[model samples]
Target chain A: MSAWGMIKTIIFGGSTLAFFFILWFYNPFKHVEHYEVEKDVKAIIDNPWKKTESGKTIAEEGRELFVANCSSCHSLRYDGIYIMSVQTNPKWKNIEKTAGRPVYRYGKLYKDRFFVPKDVYEAFAHDDLQSLKASFGQVPPDLSTIYLARGEGYLYEFILNPQKVLPGTSMPQIFNPQFDPQAKEKVAKIVAYMKSVNTPPPQEQFKRTVMGVVVIGYFLLMGLLLWKYRQNLLKRLGYH
Target chain B: MGLISKFIDWIDERAHIREIYRTQMVEYKVPKNLTFPYVFGVLALVTFAIQIISGIVLLLYYKPSIADAFDSATYSIMGEIPFGWLFRHIHATGANFFMAIVYLHMFTGIYYNAYKKPRELVWIVGWLIYFVLILTALSGYLLPWGQLSYWGFIVTTEIPGSLAEAPIFKDFFKAVAETIVLWMKGGYVVTDVTLGRVFGSHVLIYPLILLALVGTHLYLVRAAGISNPDGIEYDKKKNPDKFVPFHPYITLKEGAYVMWYLAIFFFFVFFHISHFLPPDNFEPANPLKTPPHIAPEWYLLGYYEVFRSIPDKFWGFVAFNALLLLLLLLPFLDWSPLKSARRRPLFFILFLIFMFSSMALTILGTMPPTPQNAMLGLIFAALVFGFFLSLPIISIFEYGWYKMKTKGGQKE
Candidate 1:
């Protein structure tokens, strides 16, 4: 090889190594939280407010409290608790048409069973973003997917003091200790409920694991076959 | 001898299949001196195939509208559809790999002087394909309607808007810039209409242009024959030993390279998916809230740094585009009779400078645009431009020196 070629190789190889090293050191997405529902459930169960004197699970009590306090704005659609009325209702038939058949069926199965108040459902079904913003200063986000996006820790902090966690947030401190004495327990339970509902179903995990294994294995096998075939061909060509 | 042979014979009689195959594949001759770097072009084609297959699968589930685009792309496909996550990762990672391979292929072409003489059209067409690929990538990046998608779109589309600050024809330039940005965004701002426009262009328009350009590029390659690493033109009839048929030799080699590429590609798909997906992109588009740090994907970072390095926005935009234009005009700019840099120390040094400066600029692009970084970026950007602008002069000197050495009883 020429001196230039050697220099090129050294520079390319060194840069590639340096790039990978930087990627390892920085780890750009290191802070991204990966939620595991079972771990969260175990944590909730081990908490001091695991069960109320009424013998309710934390998640169960959280659900009741969420409906009374938070459900006026936020909807738990992942838990089959959409704020919108049932798809079968005449006023909501357009949602069925727009959302397609599967979603309509989902709405039919879940929306009818969930007991959202008439007024709240009416406001949501009418697509009343203007009034919602006027009331809360901003339209509230759906809580169903929030657990996965923000994680339990951030949610706990945000719920405990909305202004401190996210200044100018539309959400008020609903569980303020000045107004509600059981603020800490309520925040814990709400987070627990969020975890319970938003935890990915086991089938999703199984599918990802199985698919990843199969794909990687197939590629490995193919690569080995190709490597063997290449060696044979090179030998036949008198190049080995 | 059985059904397959009979079927092939039936088709051959009607379509002249044997003649086509013999001309395009069986009798096609590639230079024997070609090394592993030669595989990068074929690897690029393979990566494009991966992108097309995976992209089509993604399109089946991708929603183009703003409201549902994020949910459909993320939750509906990744969380609901079977093996959708695999295809999504494959498509995303394949794009990155595609750019990497194309860069390697282009560098290989430069090293071998593959763009000289009859192969200029091949280089030009290949560059067009590359340019359109960048467009397709930029447009597709916005389809998911993530925060990065939206904000990245804003940053890229707003590049031309820097013309508003141009020293000449301030009013007219400002109007033209505004008009161009508006047209690109499909409105005064990036909105659902912009998403629709990008979706149409990304999947349909750019791919069609790329396909045509790639076809032309391949045809040009075949017509011109492969350039050898030694940069010496050899007649196949005069030196038959230096040539080999493309069928078993080239095809099998490409297949082996592809198999290795696929292994590494799948490893990224399965394990290092986060390498392609930035964390800020996890959030859906919020026009009101801009992420603190926004950068284009790694492939475009060099140009992005060139744009950022200059103090004046108008000049930065000019320099940014001038860099790409200079690269496209490389065959014409470097007028040396000798194609390869192997024997020419000046050309070799210039190539290294170009390569190092571009790499430096790319690294600078990813860093925060502080004054010191910007200063470094400016210097590297100047080096990149300097390499191209000085190429013709250096080529003249090298040619004169080569003549002197050859005249001094040196064997050509």
Candidate 2:
């Protein structure tokens, strides 16, 4: 086969896709930036009075505080909830961190999910307080699973510098990076809330190791059934 | 005043390209029954486009000198340049995905009997592309000058060096490979020499070759058209001149499929980027240190696993390599009267085994590549050989016996 064929295919296919990208990415009319915020933040917005820690440990206290202070825009799940993307705001760099993600954990869900509060927040800014008190157009994300999306270091630093990390946003910088704000007062408390929201890794995932054998067993049964089914089909078709 | 006419003239001159794109492309109608296996070809194409475009942008900022090689790459991504990070991530991420899709596509070709005679060159060219991709990945990895990139270079290139005919040749080969290693240090050895070469290859040589090869692969694919599951060529013999131009038929079909694949690719690009690639690659390459585990690209994990599981070095190397080389002989080994797997009974089972073995080996390779992994590696390697290379022969033999028994021992 001619190697050029692959090249042409890519060139042709990619150029078409690039056209789509031009539409998807370069939407000037789209001024309202959307982002996927943290889950606990969303939970607080959905129902601030919803039970906190009603379960155990520091997580319970963290949830209560999170629902009370946060939850306006943040989501309770790992998927993205539209907040704000920096590309929308021409003056995003000029604003404070309040336009992006908030610092300090309002609840347990915000602790572990690293990228939302940092990576996502750092990438965009909020446009107005109407969006802010309402949690930007995007729901704040649940921090419980943030670390898995971003990383520990990124999350930790985000908690340290919410404003500097992401310039514009409604998320207030509760922790001071210069003096290293109260361990339990600012970042630590938020982290505790995030930790409280953490759930154990899925039990079914651990069973994947045996998934190979499980698949083989499934195939074995299916193969046998298939042979029988084929035989039946053959009979119906008057082949044999 | 004459832009439209000028465009018409341009099209007239490159009429073949226009015809190829507009009409000839749709001539060979690809089977609409293709499932997930069909997406790999499209995925491979996407990867090449990403590599080429990102590679071009990166080339603008990447420095080939020893002092700034790694930093230039770092800047291209995270620095002041516009969309540098996106380009870098896309290119970097594209490498991993390309290799994976290539392997998947190659396997799909084999399992579906798409590499029978006439399309032998297609498979061979694909294999060549595989080699190019490996080189591309090797050079691209070092662009970062990180610990993984550094050691990754040493471990990978060492394989070819070991096959050198003479000691002097071997030493020279190693030295030549290590020249960039020296320059990467900002010295000789691996410090700076390696990083410089890596960045140069990543930005300059590999991307150009990749572009050329992609064109060739596509041309042949379009010229030959997608191989039917029946392993029949799209020619007078099988098609019997009942051909339709590619303009609307296949183009529409491929276009529809392309959009579906794009939806999936975009989902991963935005939402699942981290899971597909490691974060450490984002940092600049460093030569002195090593990551917790030294592993090959996910595609090579199968052989790496086999290599680790075997006790003897010679046998390990042979077993590890045979896992891939095994496919080149499939055209002959496949003795099924019908080319389609639907009729070919036993060969299909063996194909699945070959696939599973490779996948299993990749997981094993992620672990430490050490002597203690002998049993696991040996078993998997044996399976790889049995499943990939020997399965067709085994199927031929088994079917021959069944045929004989059913025919009451008639020699004819």
Candidate 3:
């Protein structure tokens, strides 16, 4: 073979071999690293908070708890400038102090004591943002989305024993010591709340009926087109 | 056939539909030498239809308010509506595949120099379609209001700010930049108004404009006729046999390709759900937070790399936009009488270099602006623009060389 031809062979053949070798050895899909959780956690579970009337109550309770405990640092809504401030502001320590929680001002007669904002009170009981940020050391992510990103089992375990699931994390073991008596119920409520807030998007299901009809319809159309094509070719060939 | 013909005649007499059909479909002729590359235009049309149908269905369930947009997409369309997932996936995945096919179609045009002579307007309109599609995709990106879509628009909106420091008319340019930013976001920042406007543009305005552009494009195509693969001019007197009606022959050929394309498209839509639509997008948009790294959709990675490679934001933005505009001007830049790369060895090799550099730039675009990637990106960006800048010079030189050789009777 010519030198150039040999070079082309080496390039194409070697690359093909290399690609397959990489695929075999380092298959990304096969080696996907799932989020690891505690031994008891299933790591992968379907929505644990089943949609029921009781489940809705538990979720509502969890929403109250989340606002009191989590919302001071985190958020549920995706809009507003506070979110942007959290992202762009580097002086978080300073902002945490001066940028006090948005509160409703009753009047000067109230001695400027912060009234829980009407919106916050309307949504749920308000928490002191200044205190929460000091404890957490940084702004916590919007927990409203944790259910979407994580399995329910993981959330349940993480909330039950945050230190157990994730070491050196700031999430206090709210259940291990106090909520332990009703830990399962509390965990369920929180999970239900997270699930309620972050509802699993209605997913695309395989439309078997549509697929069946489409496939059959397509084949029927294609067969007719092909038959006409063959007849046209035959006519062109003088096969009247 | 008889009943259909009778029905068609009945409508034709009242609506004059038969003449339109006869001119556009039955008598529309394509080159006999057409290959798989030629089918990309038809595939683009098919995917555009898919996008429109799927998008309309999605719009039925989609609420465009900021507070509700994300939930409407995730809960209502994805979770609540029956087969909503399929429509959403088809629309989302169809956009990606449509852009892919459009690129392939554009590349085929560029490779064969289909923009030459009488076909320049067709190429220009097609390029405009492509430009509008980019806007359509980006505007639709904001509708989902997910973290990725939100942050992606944030990163994109920053493009105007890059123009703030333009050396000439720095104040005026800054004002122009601010106006563009305002126009896009509709306020100081991205909010409900932004979502409302973007949603309107994506669903209503862009599609109508795209439809109009597509109509003009098809009119031009019908007028000019499809070019041959060899880049030779059509000679009616000598090459009557080279013409074929587009109905059965081309339609059947394109139909097979459409099936293959749809098979692959549906394969991703069904089997590989997250491959086209990233899971990062599932997280609701947080105005307070940006993702660790922001990137455009995968299709825009090549230009995105060029955008990020330069340290200077203004020049980087200019270079990135120039990359696409240069492609639009390829026909004019290519001064050679010879259209096809088949006979132009040097030009063919250079085209290969340009293609590889583009791929390299795309890879680089996806990576963080690490020092090594930045260096490679700068080099590849140079190679990409260098090819466009030098094409006319090389074409003139090549043409002169060929003339000299032929005049000297070097060829048998």
Candidate 4:
């Protein structure tokens, strides 16, 4: 091969390697540690009402607080209301199993019924806040995604004083620790529960071993191809 | 009979597949001097194929309704489905690369003056492809229902509202613009109805149009034959060695480039998926609360800068589309006898300046809109406009000067 041709190929191959190496180091898809709520900050004055537990333990306590307080308005799970409705309704079994069927025919009604359990129907009344909607003219947003959309910091402040954080907002301050004892502990548990509900599953980081194998395999095949095409490549480059 | 041969014969008899392949793939001739820039044409097709396949997979999980669109796209596609992030990243980043490759192909064609004489139709079809592609990308941008996408649509659609302010036929013009914008959104505001219609147009209507245009473009390329890189017309009798068959020779060269291109593509997909993303898009759309700053994807920012720089809204709308109009008029406007910039010193310098100005304007568009920045934007916008406007006059002048200097001067 001409010196110029060899130089060009080396430059191209080296740049390609360098480019991918940069991507390997700077990858956005690398596993990112998600946000988690802090459960305990030591009270400066040793407040007697504090739980003084780790965040996960506090969230465990918060589950009961959330069901009693937040469940009347904000839903805990995504589509919890829909699932509750499906359990009580009787027409859940009519959906066809045929392939290529138009999906809208099942509508919102029948689709949820397919997944509802028979025991759930007998256990609870339809749990959605339909009456709240009748009075307010707006259904409250589901809280399944609250921790994700607004970080734990916002949730803590909003719970303490809704009017102070967001003026003219519909949400009222539901807890006053001074007026009601144990309100502070209950609020902490609810915040912890909100954080626990929506934390994403951790991503598997891209493996260097797998990439090394793929690159080595690719280059091996490429080297063989280059050897096979040496004559044709030279001829095409006008060396002949 | 062998099983493979039987299957091939069955399909081949029904479709005449081999005949089509032999004619289109095997016998086609490309210029021997074709280089990396030439490969972008096929690279564009490669990226576009990636987009369509990944897009189809995404559509299976994506809900078009307002309430569900954001959650469905984010939760189902990114959080729920297996390897869903991979598909979503490929589709999103593939769209950007498709436009990037198309831009490279278009600019390379311009630098070589490929639109001269016999290839005007190919050039026109390319512009049309670009137009459809912009609309497709814009419509697709809103499907995520994020703050940036919502605001970007609002700003772009409001450009039409400027038409109402025109002097002579102000009311009629305003009515027409409003009607078109409303038709696009299916309402006065960007809501679930807007999302549904935009999604429909993005996946269904625009692709159909783009497919037809691309078919015509490829047919024209085969008909006209690939242009010589140095801008000399191909003559078989003069040097038959200058042409090579597409299948093995050109195909092999392009295959290597495709490998390199895919490496770059995967680099963005893996590491820099957010390279084109505005951070504001992480927040869901809130009609009551507008983001502090708004901008488009980087590719369209140059024109967006021009639009924002103009204080007069009516003139800004006119100027925005007029830039595209200038591109459409390029073949006729450039009256130079010479075809390639390689032989033209003055034009090459000007082209460099034009490219720099365009890049600068794009960067400037992302900065806070201040008077000083706006002034710079206006200056760059004028330079870009002048570059297109002066093409014919400059070509004529330069060619005349060359002829005067050397009576025997001829383009090699």
Candidate 5:
């Protein structure tokens, strides 16, 4: 073989082997394990709320305030509504009991029945939606998952003065030092309530790890086979 | 004859398919000494295909609206759709890889002097394709409506506003810049309208332009033929032994390299997915709040640094554009008979410096514009321009030395 031909073979073989070794060496499962554990510990340490002067936890005070004030517009039962409907709604119950075959057939219907709020489930949901939109200029978003999406700091600022934080926002300034003396504490409590109700989505470590192994293995095998085939073909062509 | 052969013959007779095939692929000859770097063009095309396929798959679940775009991309697609995460990962990673491979491909072209003489159109078209690809990537980045996407869009689109600060024609330039910025954002600020416009451009407009450019680029490559590392053009009729048919020899080699590329690509897609996804992008876009440090994707960092290095916004914009224009005019700038840097030591060293300086600029681009970082950025940015500006002088001197050496050797 010529010098160039040998270099080609070496590069081809070396890169293929090196990439495969790198893929095998970096175990995604182990990384995911460390990532999730660290995240959980961080979350625990990062909890900001404290007990009030009255011995009430901030989250408890926030929950009471939320029920009195924000509950008129925003519902804290977003995910709960879905879970409750799945268990108690006759239509959903029938679909759930039918196992795989009917579930597949009723997939579209199942999706529709999945996430109905308490007010929507009760009566005149469409009318209620229009009225709510008419009143607020836009339908108020559920506060249940707001904490997960917007961090505590943003939630605090937004709840304290919606207009100040987001100019042109339809949300009214419900809590302020001018209107209420303990407005800062009230906003903090609201944020604490939001944080307490919402949990981040569970880490899919098992699925991701399995996928990483399978995908890496498949590519590694394909690469080796191609390398072998290429070498043989080049040899036969008298190029190697 | 087999039925397939008969059918092929019928098609060939009418369309002259055999002639086209013979001229284009089967009997087309390239230099025998072409090496590993040549495979990057093929890898780039493969990455393009991956992006297109995965991007289309992602579009199925991607909501272009600002309100739902984040959740649709993350919760709906990544969580709900089976192997949807894989497609999203591939699309995201493939975009970065596409830019990476294109940079390598461009470097390979430069190193081999593939942009010289008859291959200028090829380089020009390839550059246009690179430009469109960046635009497409930028537009696509905004589709997720994440924090980085939102802020990055704001920062990038507002770059044109610096034109208003130009010393001359202040009002006219200001009006034009403001209009352009407003038009790009679809309002005074980035919003739902901006998302819609970006989505339209990303999926429909930029891809169309890219495809057209890519087609022209490939045609130009075919017409010009591939340049080799030696930078010596060999006519097949004159020296048939020095050339090989591209069909099996080149295709087989490309296949091996492609497999290697895929292995590394999938490894990142599966294990190091976070490399493509910045943590800031995990959060949905909040127009009220801005990220502390907003930067473009890794590929655009060098240019971003060049923009930041100059304190004046207007001059920085000019410098940024000047760098791109200089790169495009590389063939015209360096007028030397010695095409290959291997034969030109000075050019090779300058090229290395240019490459390192740009890399340094890219690293600096990621950091906050501190005094030290800004100073380093300015230095590297100067080196980058210095390489281009000094190319012609160095090339002329090198040519003179080469001529003298050869003439002296003949006398001896």
Candidate 6:
């Protein structure tokens, strides 16, 4: 057999073997943490700062780190989430929603749209920001009710125990920065920022036209790259 | 007679299949003295299989729509179905296990100069498989549409999101990041739409990529054979028949290693009870709901630290990408003509520091990215980076340092 053919067969066989093994040996969904808003950060990491604003303490320091590392992902909305001692059987469906469905999310505040404040250029795709807008439609959900909406401390716990929180999280480790000593301090400060950010964002007076020029430029480049990649794919697939 | 003739013709076309199967079953050859580290690659493959089978079974009971996605995914595991939780934990834990083995295999290969000479393609193919595994792991994490998965995805994408200001990347940055994420989400803003797409990609697209890579890698290894201890030579005259059949000879050795993998998988599966993130994920992926700390998966610590370490954007990109890129370049690094780790003591020590530094950075990256934290992260990251950059230079310097010390003759 040709070398490529042999490789193809091996891969195919290996793939089949893998498929059977997972079926026999383990659960695929077990790693997926079901969604509930009770943050378990305390359990994941030892957070000296529970809910205090004390300065220079682990709590305050964690807030700084939270802002640096997390603010971008986490909204500073105090009201949107609800924090309580985690109940193992706390009604997962007890979550408040619009018409028995989970309330849809909007982009962050301080921008014209929910997604506008997001770094659109750095998102997974240009349409990603747009689809973000399209998905939620007009009024993005506000953070004013998140703590009440989800719960407090859940966010903290999620951050703290990411692996225990969710497997394959892109978030790297923080508590055991075995090489980097400053990791704990950074997390503390970031958490502090989240705590401090309570007020809802004021209405935007800025142009709704563009956040940065990334939107337009991103389209042109992606179009070209996609086209080139398609051409390459066609060649590889012998489609001409 | 015509029908019989047709059947015979069909059988003839696929005659090679029968032979190929027999060839591996009966006469496949492998090197003797292959070490435990080599088994990791196959072990990862085994775990990959386990994940796929269990994943498909879970899909039978899963509803990928945002409305019931979390619940369905949740029920599929939480022991609602017979042995359902087993499937879920196996796949999830298996992902982590797969990563561990891949890292082990890669690192061992490097330490033994496994990428040198005939095994170069093996190394390259192996790394490609690792890349596919990352993509698979990323997609699988998203399928549950849980709180951690949602926030975790955001954290994972955050750095890439901030790269929008690349000065040159422009809209392509926005378009690429936004669209793909949109695709991952099936819509945007981490909705059911996103969950569905991520599910399909996790189960199908990514797995296909992984399988392809694994196939190519295994073939490459067979074709090139395994790299041995650094000092070993391949002279046909010196040792004509130093190899053994892979089936009975090597498989028996691999048997013990496989047992260890199974034990680890079950240990986490049962005792850990699928240690998923906190319960906030039952709600749909909510953007407004931000988890206070946003750390990436553990494997990416070094790059994460590099991102935190550097306050700047472009440099952060360079440093972050460089950490992994350097691994790909191990073939070119350390040109002291001494191939083995044992031969060059200083190289070995510095490289150990580099590995530890990477591990440290990965852990550090998981924390919040505050300035104080970042500044310290940077210092520590710099120390680690120093570890990587100083290897060859230090390896060179040590040669002189050793000579100078010896010439001084201060020893008793």
Itemize residue pairs with steric clashes in candidate 4.
none
Interface RMSD of 6: 21.3
Number of the top-ranking candidate, with lDDT as the measure = 1
Residue-level lDDT of model 3, residues A122-157, one tens digit each, is 233123444555778754665545676665767777
lDDT of 4 at B208: 92
Taking the tens digit of each residue's C-alpha lDDT, what string does model 4 give over A27-50?
Answer: 342333343334452131112223
- CA lDDT of A24 in candidate 5? 30
Ranking by lDDT: 1, 5, 3, 4, 6, 2
Superior candidate under TM-score, 1 versus 4: 1
Please identify model 3 stretches exceeding 4 Å from their true place.
Answer: A1-145, A150-170, A174-240, B1-8, B15-24, B167-169, B402-412
Cα RMSD (angstroms) for every candidate in the order listed? 5.0, 16.4, 9.7, 8.1, 9.3, 20.3
Q: For candidate 3, lDDT tens digit of each residue in B283-391? A: 7787886777787876788898888888988898899888888888887898787776656677777777787787677656666678988999999999999899989
Lowest lDDT 10-residue stretch of candidate 2 chain B: B159-168
TM-score of each: 0.85, 0.57, 0.76, 0.74, 0.74, 0.57
The interface RMSD value for candidate 3 stands at 11.3
* Model 4 docking grade: incorrect
Q: What is the TM-score of chain B in candidate 5?
A: 0.94
Estimate candidate 4's alpha-carbon lDDT, on a 0 to 1 scale. Answer: 0.69
- Residue-pair clashes per prediction, in order, are 0, 106, 7, 0, 0, 114
- Which regions of candidate 2 fall more than 4 Å away from where they truly are? A1-240, B1-23, B26-36, B65-67, B159-188, B222-225, B232-245, B282-286, B332-337, B368-374, B398-412
Indicate the fraction of true inter-chain contacts that candidate 1 also forms: 0.24
Better of 1 and 5 by DockQ: 1
DockQ of each: 0.25, 0.03, 0.09, 0.09, 0.17, 0.02
* Model 2 docking category: incorrect
Give the distance in Å from residue A137's predicted Cα in candidate 1 to where it truly belongs. Answer: 2.6
Docking class of 6: incorrect
Q: Summarize candidate 4's per-residue lDDT along B230-347 as a digit string, tens digits.
A: 7788775687788766766766666666666676676666556655543456566768778766778767988889988988888888897899999988989887877777666667
Deviation (Å) of B105 in candidate 2: 0.9
Provide candidate 6's TM-score on chain A.
0.28
